[model samples]
Target chain A: MIIDINAFLGHYPFRRLPHNSARTMIELMDAHGIDSAVVSSLHSVFYRDAHRGNEDLFLETKDFGSRFVRVATVNPKYVSWRRDLDEAMDRWKMKAVTLFPAHHGYLLSDVECQQAIEEIVRRDIPLVLTQRLEDRRQRHHWDAAEDLEFKSVLELVRQHTKLRLALVNWIGLDGKRMAEAGLQGRCLIDFARLHVLLNKDVDKLISSLGITSIAFGTHMPFDYVGPSLVKLANLESNPAIDYPAVSWRNAARFFGLEGGD
Target chain B: MRKIDVHNHVFDAVDQPGANWARVESMIEAAEWLGIETLCCSRPITGGAMAEIAEVRRANDAVLATMQRYPDRVRGFCFIQPGNGRLAIDEMQRCFDQGMIGVKLYNQFKYADPMVYPIAEKCIELRIPLLGHSAHLTDARSIAAQPMTSDSLEFCKLATRFPELILILGHINGGGDWEWAIKGLRECENVYLDTSGSVLENDTIEMCVRELGVKRILFATDQTMEGCVGKILSAQLSSEQREDIFWKNAHAIFARRTS
Candidate 1:
């Protein structure tokens, strides 16, 4: 079984996402042979009341059963974030909590963010962070959100030794840096944005971070599902790598699901 | 079905030099893994800035050697800097006659510049496609190090001047407002958009196919092999449309465009 560690539901502010609904998402998953996907609210990224997008995501994925796993985005900068995070956990049963620190106008190093991670860690849920949802260079003129700086991310990973952080749509990071920064197994990076062939970054990443730290993800609605699937294909073809860990095992374990190694 | 990657680079032996021969081998290994049959490759010398004519020729010679090494797998595109005036055309023709299939232009000069006209005309005379690098950006163009880079609007200008020129716009999805690029580039019936690079975004191929149609799109990776191919598969395209973009259109670019 394949689980997409990263996927999104809700309307993108700029440009049209033809497959923005849960129905289209399921269709895409079926097309790519992905059994499940951990989905978050794209609307939460733009909405000032971030929980409103969580509500939207809840209404959409609530009836879908286990095929869709909800990932709630909590903005620590927002005043109601403390109450919202608890509400998301208790009511929405959010399996994971994602933070768009860059878009939320805060740093991963912030006290507010640190507190949030503390809360997430205590609850035993993985904290989802992303380098970017969109390629900054290709962003719409209005999308001025800066990418997550590596130093801030490194800072957080070092501080929270037990925090399980799934980094989605990340680029340019290799295994060596992860080892040096002591960010290896604690952080799980998805392949939605990693170049499997061009840079052969996956080869470098697996060598340093080990297969367990890598997971499958597709930044859908904003991006295609096929890149990660094809990446899995490439991984399977490589005799040295364990394809199942990247394909679903790591993601399943990271999300606290069944079917993990 | 076979695939033709119309635009990618040869990064071995200067360009960055033989320091990266392993990289060249890895690119071939990737192409083979992905089922890519032909790689229309070049060695872009300007590196991201303007280059002298001699420097440009040296880079093209790298492509010549790469093409010779791969032979059937690798095809060459003689890279040129339009600012070099007649010398640019001389190098372009020299490489073409010596088996380079097309011309590759970077961001040193915009597409609409007078210097580009002669090169475009040279492409017309040789019946070869001209692959011009572009990025559709607005306020923060300087950050990308492509100050004078051509956008879709400039490509439109050049296409209007030389209707017969087989102008393949490099990497519509390379980076920057692709929706803007698609809408802005709609009128240039002759400018074929190579769906490459930022195929990261879903529906890019569908939007491109919708705006530019099947016959005007070509498949390329600009180094992002899986993303580029995946972009086409993600699009709602017919078999015929896919075939056209994959090879037929790019194949036609090399055949006599005097039609």
Candidate 2:
């Protein structure tokens, strides 16, 4: 039950990588033993229309069976956001939504935005928020993050009470601090971009978070899967916590795939 | 036999640029074939201005995924842009609180840049080592291209500024920088070097062996994208030095840092 928790489809304008079809990505995932992936669309975020990417990603995941779950990147701030969400679920059949606050340019705490988040939570669809992409020093756009106020994101999550967030792009240091701050119980952090420090810390992190707050991810189509999976496969975690169940089971439960085989 | 890797990187696989899952898998398959106990990968480090915080955070998301993927075999470093002190600290606290052991800095940015002082000070106060690039004998031309020596000096300055912090200078070979680094960094007891990159000049290793002793040196591969076998075997110091550099020194540092 290996799950690649973090993934994107379509063309990303910032990175000059060729876009691979979802079928090709699935083949690649199969080769790496990734049983499932939570996918978003790169083109949608770039164009400020997650629907385009969400439509393609939804069609792609439906064909992949349970191996791929459609996690559409949504921008609630859009006036047509209600139609967008309905179409994404009804038309695309997606079970999750990934919101890019910085790229989408709407504070999570916005009144309308908070209402939308509540609606998504009411639907029981997982909401994954992509925090940031690059270190501030290395951003392709110098001022891309200047207007980003993460407090709004955190506060929104706290306010929702029932909102369970799947945070992507959480680095080593920040992820740990979030765990220490007790964000893990309510928010699951997908380790899609972590690399540094000691291997033992992985077990420690999982243990600290009680496994339920953890999920496996590989930022695929940008980087390869070998190192991504190897980081986990190489750890010497206790056998009980080191199983695929810990990797995929918790994620399956979080995303409402509890009965998934 | 707990092994620690202080540097690494992970990118989004869904929108891959260079190699895909197969490429990275085979590479790791090869590493596993060679018996590397563990390796830590970082969120991808893209070179650019400090204003690219969002991009950095995106890269960091991938890093978080990697750490969660292999909790036993790998750990992750929070690659930070020193320009946003407040945000960077928030990220450091976030990742560190999540159980990350330290932070990483690329030489593309300076160690002594005024923007970075706050970050260094925080790491020192928190007792997390800032793993960064450094060279001993640097070529001025390559220095312009990479700025290894200047960054190394600034690393020393960082140690001087925050005496309790541990600054691990990555890569002790492929140039004469390690040789010169010993002189500049020796006075700062908190400063240490990780034996990585190309093989060190035996004389340089010997000098470090006698002067700084093995305790000041550590064994690292800097081989995130490369094979780790060669780098692991590259620690050509004596068995005693090997003990300290390969495992003991890291354990000591980890113990203190973790506490």
Q: Candidate 1: where are CA atoms >4 Å away?
A: B14-20, B139-144, B257-259
Candidate 2 lDDT over B1-259, as tens digits, reads 3345455445444223452455335435534543545555665454434446776666666666656656666666777877666888888888787777778876546777777788888887777777876654333444455543343566777778877888887766534445456667767777887655533222445556666777787766665422232233332356665556656777687677657
**Alpha carbon lDDT of residue A218, candidate 2?**
61
TM-scores, chain A, per candidate: 0.95, 0.85
Candidate 2 residue A167 Cα shift, in angstroms, is 1.6
Per-model DockQ: 0.64, 0.03
List model 1's recovered fraction of native interface contacts, to 2 decimals: 0.61
TM-score of model number 2: 0.53
Error of 1 at B213 (Å): 1.6
Quality of candidate 1 docking, DockQ: 0.64
Q: How accurate is candidate 2 locally (lDDT)?
A: 0.63
Q: Which 10 residues in a row give candidate 2 chain B its minimum summed lDDT?
A: B226-235
Tens-digit lDDT track of model 1 for A86-176: 8888998899999988788887878998899998989889988877777667666788788887667777777887787788888867568
- What are the clash counts of all predictions, listed in order? 4, 90
Query: How much of the true contact map at the interface does candidate 2 reproduce, as a fraction?
Result: 0.00
Instruction: Report the number of the highest-lDDT candidate.
Output: 1
